[model samples]
Target chain A: MAEPLLSIEELVVDYGRIRALKGISLSVGQGELVAVIGSNGAGKTTMMKTISGLLKPTSGRVMFDGKPLTGVPAHRVVKLGVAQVPEGRRVFAQQTVRDNLVLGAFLRLRSGQKREVAEDTERMFSIFPRLRERQDQLAGTLSGGEQQMLAIARALLSRPKLLLLDEPSMGLAPVIIDEVFALIERLKAARDTTLLLVEQLAFRALEVADRAYVIEQGSIKLAGSAKELLANPSVQQAYLGAAATH
Target chain B: MQTLQLLISGVAQGMIYALVAFGYNITFATSKTLNFSLGNFLMLGGVVGFILYMTHNWPFFAALAAVVLVGMVGGAVLLKVAVEPSLNQRSAYGWILATLAVGIVLRNAAEVFWSTDDFKFRSPLGDSPWRFFGEPQPDGSMSGGLGVYPQEVLIIFVSLAIVAAVELFKRRTVFGKAVVAVSEDKDTASLMGIDQKFVILFSFMLSTAIATVGGVLVAPITLVSATMGTVLGVKAYSASIIGGLESGFGVVVGGLFLGVSESLTARFVSTGYKDVPGFVVLVLLLLFKPSGLFGRAAIRKV
Candidate 1:
């Protein structure tokens, strides 16, 4: 079998003394959409941050595209084709939407891929037409849903081999959440991106992801194909809000 | 005519303060730290230039270039030795004391090398005043035109040019944008593949370079002394605070306002009270609009 695109082994991360991620391990295959679902403080965000080089793991290793990314700084992680859409969609609020998108392609611009960068920028605008309409507006003024779309589009502008999205459905209206999920579905159907999504919206995430892991208190409690997890009684009881017990 | 002359001189002096305050803004924007030794950098520029040109017989342009290079290096050192370590501790006011210590060290070092006495810095532009429009004197002798020293005019022009150039660079260039991005949100900038530490270091270098240039320009007017930076540095800090610490344009406006007020007081009120208005305005502005005239209050998300 082809090697997994990303591999995390027995990762342990600590914030001072409290272990945020305790002996957690996971992997993503090429062209796969993997969702890790958990409640708040379940180490989902910590895991994503570790993989993207934002946080250092006290023990264990993160191998991305056959590289040990344990001690690499966050800025260098982008060069390895890993883009993270951090929690809360931290767009450059003072900058214009267009500027934010352009900054997403900062590495490309720095490398003098001017023509390609411009083309990709246009592609982003086309993909998110709402963003195109508000291209000149300050990103802070955009609605929450639009900001999330901008964040995702900005990540894609980097043309990453792996997209780490933390809480994409967070703080959105039900209709907006549906729209975001639909966009993710379309992205998955395009089949050119590998995504590791962390979500609190378990049922919705399972519906879209090909495989899912249920993490409780920084450790994986269950892992299975999305269909299996969706049908499993324990997952249904704990996450899906269905009163089912195995 | 007197008022016009005061206005011109005030504006010229104000430009120097603006330059210094602008330096403060550059460093503060990237790292949220201010270099107390900024004024010392300005003094270094003038004293270094004076030593090179007047004492060592170096040409004016060469002396200026050498001073600027020294200022750049001083800025890098200030970042590494003062600002960066303080920031690493994440203590709120640690950098303040650390940078002030650096300034004191620089001032003492200058004293050791150049002596404490103020030395006349010969202007490369010559001491001749440019006359714009002369009026007839009471004794029937023509003495009407407003006369401005060429160095003062140079100060005005260079300050404006630097501000414009920096504004353009910040808005147009990718690297400049990275600096801005780092200033706005360091974590987000890092995630965007920008090295925040490098940007902060570059800002300190730029800040010191600007202060050095200001010193070189003002030296011909104020003369060079090891202690010259003390009052000027305090006033520049005042100018930055009054202008709003975050706003670059605000610093210029604040500097000009403070300069004009000081000049006007010295002329109309009393020369003894010349420095009174800047501090007074600073107090009043702090009481009312702490964000300054052109500064926007920052909004933070939890």
Candidate 2:
């Protein structure tokens, strides 16, 4: 395959001597959707954070669009076409929905792309019509699913080349999770941006992903095409609620 | 008439406190740290203004411009020397002590380099009271109702203008909104490519600059001295706390309440008891609503 959009090489991260991601490696090719599905404490979020420049890895490399991203602060990381929808849908709660959308295009607006930014904001409103209806409403007043939609819209406004989505289904109702996943599938079908998603609902992620990595105890235990993994006995037994003896 | 005059005087004084309190709020919002040396920054402006405008006879506006310049530079230096280092360290209260130390150093430096004794600062608008509804006497004295100082009027107008301008900036401008974003959530804000460190630095600069201008404006009413900012700083800080550190309008109300209360108490009660009633109210108010008037109580996530 032509060089992947994002590549991680033997990435190791620690939380004060408690190793979270131990020598893990992964990659996402251009216009591909790759999912990392695992249970809690599997270092999936840690890996996402490291990729987005929020956490410093003790050892290893994160190469994005042919540049080493280690030690670059999170603020600079986003400017280089990498944006993450952090876990828990962390929107600017105090600001209006419109303001949140405007801020998503922050770097673009700064470099004299006001017209493009404004156009993109309208595009976001079109994609999520609920946002258009409540553009003037404070983001904090939105329901859990709406906040998640706003968060995705906010990140998408950056027009990122690579998007890291950490737990899109976190703390959402089952119906909202389905809606979020449907949006993800729509984005995947469009095929313009590469995505690296970390999710706890293994089956749900595997349902839409082209390929999936199953992580356990801070390491990738399985990696393969989604169809192959869905057929695998172990993946089904461990994550898909199949009856099996531990 | 006496009550009205007292109200005006109190309002002017209170506005100064509100302006300085606003300085405290700006820095605190961006960085979660207060510039304890803010009051001394005000003193620095006053002394500098006095030297240029009175002693050296520079044009009033030029002196004011120079004072503002000094304030900006001082604020930047303060952030670099006092705030950033503490933020880098592990200690939570390091910044508080660091800022307090900077304030002390500024006060001592002023005392040693300049005069320890107080000096009168002549107002650009003249020191004489503007008598309203007055009857001129045979001795050319206008003994009248509601006599007000031009300086006090200037103080009220200028302070309100500064507060309104800053509040508008935060609400209207993109860069200003970036500052607000950083205050709300620095980590999430970074995902939007907002440089929070730069925001913090900008806040410090703006806060100190406001305090310095306040010092220059207030010098005509009070005296210019090293000790000038000590009490004013404490009261401004108190005013900020009383108003709700997060709310812009709250500080104004807090300052006005304190100012009017002090003025009334000074006239009706003993002059020494002027500070007592305000402090007592602050203590009582905080006991019920720790967030201050207009402040929202923080709800922590479990």
Candidate 3:
């Protein structure tokens, strides 16, 4: 395997007195889609937050492409090409959809190069045509699925090398969830984007991810190829339900 | 004719109030906190300008530039000491009171340095009377047509120019868009590499500069004193709240509206009760619109 692009070594995170992540270690190669599968409160989101610099880890280190990401602020993290599409699709509700996306690449924008930003925006619109349909619409008014799409599209505007997606399929219809998954698969294939995805939908996430880690109570319980994890008896019992167990 | 002149002067005074309102709007849009001490910044503008012009003997343009630069610096300090600390502690009220405290200190410091006596600011636009339908009479008094002084014209033009410039910047500039982004979601703006702290600092500085200019321009018409900006800042804030702090155009229009309305009320009604209409509008706006005339209603999400 190529040298790891991201390495989270023995990372531990705490929320006040509560230990959210306990000595968890994982790595992603330069061009790989890795998935962390867990139920709610399994520390999947906490891990992603810590990596994104929204939350600080109590111990261990997050190294991205050989750079130590210790105690860096979230905004500065983005400049290093790590863009996180946070859970719940927190779009800027008051702003228009286009403004929302434009803000994604705000740090790099120059006063004289508005046309360039517009072009990048148009590129995002082409990938997610639904967003193009409502460019001027307020982001808050978008439906849950559209908001999810908007969240991802906005992240893409940052031209991220590493895309961290947290629960992209949460609270979406079956069709919309499929659409989101399809887009993720496309992004991984076309852009050569490194993805660290946290998801409750194990089967769906594994379909796109090359490797999978099953986290339980803030520790990695199992790690294997997508095929191996899917065939694991405990994962089938706990997450995939009785139908998969059979 | 005397009454007409005072009414014109009152409108000019109102315009100054509106300009200060714009400053309050800038800070309020970003942090949802209005600096109650905004007036002190305005007072500092006049005091600083007077010192530069009269004491330091700087040219009028140089004095104006120096005062504005001082206002910007003062704004940055206000954010650092007042805003940043309070935001870190999740205690927003500290910013309000801290800023107010800073204002009091500045005003008192000015009093001690400049003394408590009132003084008139020399108008850079000169003592020439302009034909606002008529010229001034021989007796240092405006006569002929609907006589107006050139300084009043300068005041009108400058206020309008600032408003126009602000509107253009907000709409067209990249920094302006970044500010809008910051206002919408600071986290995202930061994530995009738009330095959240820098944007906050810029907004405060820009806001104070405008308010300071309002003070500088109107000081000639009103007495330059420590108390010059206290009531004016409050009234201007009322205008911002009434005009929707989010929209740059709304601030200017709200200011003009307040200024013109106050003049008309004082003319047709009681001069002593001129301020009553502005406060009444503020109360009514809070009770009814709450969002202000130009403000968009924000919908809360869980």
Candidate 4:
């Protein structure tokens, strides 16, 4: 197997005495789409936050590309080729759709690739045509699904090697959820982007992700390939209850 | 003719107030903190310019440039000690006191250097009488029966220029766009490679430089004094509260409105009551529309 793109070892996080993540260890290989599924308060979001540098880990190691990421700030993480689409579609609501996308390429300007950046933005528009239609409109006015698309597109604009998404399909219609999933699949296929996704949607996550980790109460209860875990009786009981067994 | 004179004076005074109000908006928008010492920065601008001209014998243009440059430096220093450190600690109140202390120190230091006596600097616009439709006073004053001074015209011109330039920059430049992003959401903006602390410092410097210009413009009419900026700062804050600090356009409109109204009140009503109306408007605005007239209300998702 190729070298892991990201590795977390013995990561511990606390919210003022309440332990959110307890010594969790996980690793993802290059171009792999890894899904982390757990109920609310199960430490999944906390893990993503720790990796992205939004929240510092109390103890443990986060290594990206063989470098320690313990003290890096969130924005520097993007510079190191990791971008996060934060929970709740925090898409700079007051800005125009085009402005939101422009900010995604903030660090790219230093690389002196303006023309390619413009082309990438055009490609993003083509992928999400609705965004192109509402390019001038304020992001706050976009519909729920469109906002989600904007959020993902904004993250993709950074041209990150690894995309970390937190609850991308939350509160979306079933059809829109499928569309978002399809977009994620397309991104991974075309861009060779590594994905570490946190989702509560069990079956859909397993369908898109090559490997899965089930977390509960700040610890990982199980981990395996999608097909193997889907067949595992305990995994089914923990995530899908009686439906998966059926 | 007298009514035209009052209108000219109102516009000039309004221009000065608008600049100060914009300064308040810049720091408030980016940092969500107030520099109660804003007026002192304005005072420093004029005092510094005057010192450069009268004491150091610098040319008018050079003195003006020196004033602006020094104001920018002062703003950066204020940000480093008063704003940035406080922001790191998440202590908003520390910025308030720290900025006020800096202002106090700067003002007193100026007093020691310049003394308290008022001095006149020749207007670059000269003694030319600009009459809209009136005869010069019998005393040969340029009031031209309208109280319009040549320097006041300069004040109006400079104020409009600064506002127009800032608006264009915010719309067209990459740096300006990044500033808007930081103002909208600091954490997310930082995630996009924006150094928000630096942006905040740059914004405060820009605002202070503009305010210093406003001070230099109006210093001829109102004698430059260390204490001159305190009341002006309060009035400008009132204007910001009136305009809605969230929107730049709103801040300017509110400033002009307050300036003209204050001028009218001072002329017709008691000068003491001139600021009263502004403070009343401020209270009413906070009570009724905390977002200001042009500010958009954000929804709390949680």
Candidate 5:
């Protein structure tokens, strides 16, 4: 079998005294969507940040496309075809939407791919047409859902082989959450992009993910096909809350 | 006529303060730290330009170019030596002391090399005053006229031009946009593949180069001295705070307002009380709108 696109082995991360991720391991094959679902404070965000080189892991090895990601700076990680839409959609508030999209292709810009960057920006506008209407408006003026779309669009403009999205459904209405997930689903179907999704909304994430991992209190408790996890009685009780006595 | 002269001089002086304040904004915006050595950098520009032009008989433009290049390198060195080390320690006030120490050293070096006495810096534009709107006095002498120095006009023109160019760079270029991105959120900027360290270094270089330009322009009027940057730096800091450190245009407005107030106070009250009005306005502005007249209130994100 071909090597997985991303491989994490026994990753451990600590924030001072508190251990955030304790010996967690996961992998995603080429063109696969992997979901890691857990409640808040379960270290989901920490794991994602560690993988994208935002946080330094205490002891671990992260191999992305056969390169070690550990100790590498976050900016250099993007050049390795890995892009992350960080939690809370941290868009440049004072900048225009178009500028945000353009900055997303900063690596390409630095390499003197001006024409390609412009073409990629136009491509992003097509993917998120709402952005086209508000292209000139400051990203701060955008609504939560619109900002989320802008963040996703900005990440997509980087043209990454692997995309890590941390809590894309965060702080949006249910309808907007569904819309965002639908957009991700469409992206997966239309492109060969590998996705590592960290989400608190287990059911929604499991519905679209090809494979799933259940992380609780900084460690993975279960890993299997998404369909299998959804049907598992324990998962239904813990995450779905279907068999709760209360 | 007297009031108009004061106003014109006030505007010219304000432009110098605005230029210095704008330099403060550049580094502060990028790294959230101010280079206290900024004034020393300005002194270097004036002193270097004077030496190259007057002492060595170098062309004026060549002297100016050499000063700018040296200042740029000095700024980068400051970041590496003073800023990066302090930041690495994660201590907020460490950089304050580090940069302050660097400033003192630079001032001392200049004092040793150029002496403590002030030196006249000849402007490339001749010292002859251009008289405008003259009206004959009762004794058949020109009384109601404006005496404008060519260098003063250049100061005002260059101030506006620098501000406009920086504004344009921030809006139009990819590198400029990277700067904006890093300023807004460093983590997100890194995710976009921007090296935050490089941006910070670039801002320092830009800031120092700007201070050098300010020094060169004002030296003709103010005289070149090792310690000249001290008062100018303090006033520029006040200007930046009064206008809102985050807003470029606000700093200019604050600078002009402070300048006009200082001149008016000097004429109406006493020259000894000239600096008082700027401090008074700064205090009043801080008491009321701490963000500054044109500064935007920071938005809190959960």
Candidate 6:
């Protein structure tokens, strides 16, 4: 309640004439892991994009660190300590794994954190050992799960105060999806950063989230503690079908 | 010996084309827009270089530096004036025409403000050819065994150096990787905090600067004229298409192929038909491999 790190007030975004987010409001406290779970076309990615400044809301406010982030460009948004791992693990496919990691720390590198970023990169390699072994290979050659790790690691390199993970389990095998969620859980336990995860995997998301919001038809349908939502029969009947959306 | 002489000449000529083609590649790689006025930027370089080094009697290196500055500035202006507006509107054809119009205006401006007549640009290395094996004549000149112009050698080395430097920069530097990232995905690039607009602007500047320096380098052989970029620009575009717009080595290969064939055709077939073979190859090549000889066909994602 004491000035959340990110707060959206009646955010409305549109795709041309079609309204994507009619009016949505959410808030995430410092060091909190908040999950927004919804079906496809439920305005989850749009909301993430709007928060990260990839999309501008029609008539709403996005405040980050108590500063207005309504119309800031996406590039500037990253500079303001918010990074989004966009849906589909859109890695720079043409470049090598190491190059991708270096690019992840692009702003910091320019600000003279080359050695620090390099040390952080070594840390990423340690966390995902496959990345170290395949650092010289083009990122496109990486497995979907590896690519997801790379995406998250790359976003982490920016050292964002708030991280937006849009469907981290998307397009991965069920086993791999579990691994990704486990990694997300590990990050949560570390508690070095705040995270807002937009996911179609409602049950998995709720399991990891400290708090959760259910969005449907461009609006927030439910907002409560993850335990309460998980216990709620309506939430289970609607979205606890683990394989339904995938 | 005649073949060898023709080969060097062809390669040198090809490098000029390759250099300009490389310019096209840089901007296209980053922004997916070809700087249509690249040749004119080259012309701008030549004209400026001529004024400084030839007419004003400035030192060659000083003139070269000035030409490079002008080229960089010209590139930035082209991006801001012609490229950005259309891109913002999301009109695909707008940039093509905008750049073309700028090129036309540039040509007309040169003709009106300067001379329309072609002027021979004296090479800093001087006018004489470097002979491999020749008889010394009474005029203290070697009589034709194989005569390679000093300018031709300079052109080959300098062009290769430029291409090599740029390729290395893209692979080795963080800023360079950011440019590549922007090219791959503009939106994703911004997520990494890369100002993609600045990357696009930088691509334009680098593209134009390279083209301009090319003008200065090529002028000694081609002559400086208001309309010099027109045909040369078309040919360079062809070279880019033939090589693969994205491949650095491909452009050089395409340029060299065009250059050698042109030289050989002029010697064997006819001077009037010299341009025929390269265009024929380009047509045939496109029919078989549309992306270009070295171009990778992108696997489309939904």
User: What are the Cα lDDT values of the candidates?
Assistant: 0.89, 0.90, 0.82, 0.83, 0.89, 0.91
**Model 2 residue A90 lDDT score:** 89
Candidate 4 structure quality by residue, lDDT tens digits, A35-119: 9988888998889888988789999999999888888988788889888888888887877899898888877865787898899
**What's the C-alpha lDDT at position B61 in model 2?**
96
Model 4 RMSD to the real structure? 2.6
Q: Which residue ranges in model 6 land beyond 4 Å of their true spot?
A: A242-246, B136-141, B299-302
Write the candidate numbers in order of decreasing TM-score: 6, 2, 1, 5, 4, 3
Model 3 global lDDT (CA atoms, 0 to 1): 0.82
Which is the winner by TM-score between candidate 3 and candidate 6? 6
Interface RMSD of 3: 2.1
Cα lDDT tens digits for candidate 4, B1-302: 66566677877887787888888888787878877778888988888877887668888999999889988988888888777787688665887778888888877887887666676756678645565545656785544344467988888888899988997887666678788888888877877777787888899899889878877887886877777787888778777778888777888888888877777888889888877777777889899998787777863231
Q: Who wins the lDDT comparison?
A: 6
TM-score for each predicted model, relative to the true structure: 0.96, 0.97, 0.91, 0.94, 0.96, 0.98
B92 Cα displacement, candidate 1 (Å): 3.0
Task: Give the per-residue lDDT digits (tens) of candidate 1, residues B1-302.
Answer: 78998999999989989999999999999998888899989988888888898889899889888988998899999999887788789788999999999999989999996698998888889987777778766885556578888998899999999988998888789888888899899988988888888999899999998999898899989989998888888899999999998998999998898888888999999999988999998999999999888889654332
Question: In terms of TM-score, which candidate is strongest?
Answer: 6
Clashing pairs in 3: B134-B145, B136-B143, B137-B143
Q: Which scores greater on DockQ, model 1 or model 6?
A: 6
lDDT of 5 by residue, A34-143 (tens): 99998899999999899888899999889999999999999999999999999999999889999999899888887888898788788878878899999999898899
Better of 4 and 6 by TM-score: 6
User: Which tens-of-lDDT digit does each residue in A1-246 have in candidate 2?
Assistant: 899999999999999979999999988899999999888889999999999988999999999989999999999999999989999888888888888988888898888899998898888888899999999998888888999999999999899999899999888888888899999999999999898899888888888999999999999999999889888989998887731211
TM-score of chain B of each: 0.95, 0.96, 0.90, 0.90, 0.95, 0.96
Question: Which of the predicted structures, 1 or 5, would earn the higher DockQ when compared with the native?
Answer: 5
- Candidate 1: DockQ? 0.61
Q: lDDT of model 5 at residue B43?
A: 84
Error of 6 at B125 (Å): 0.2
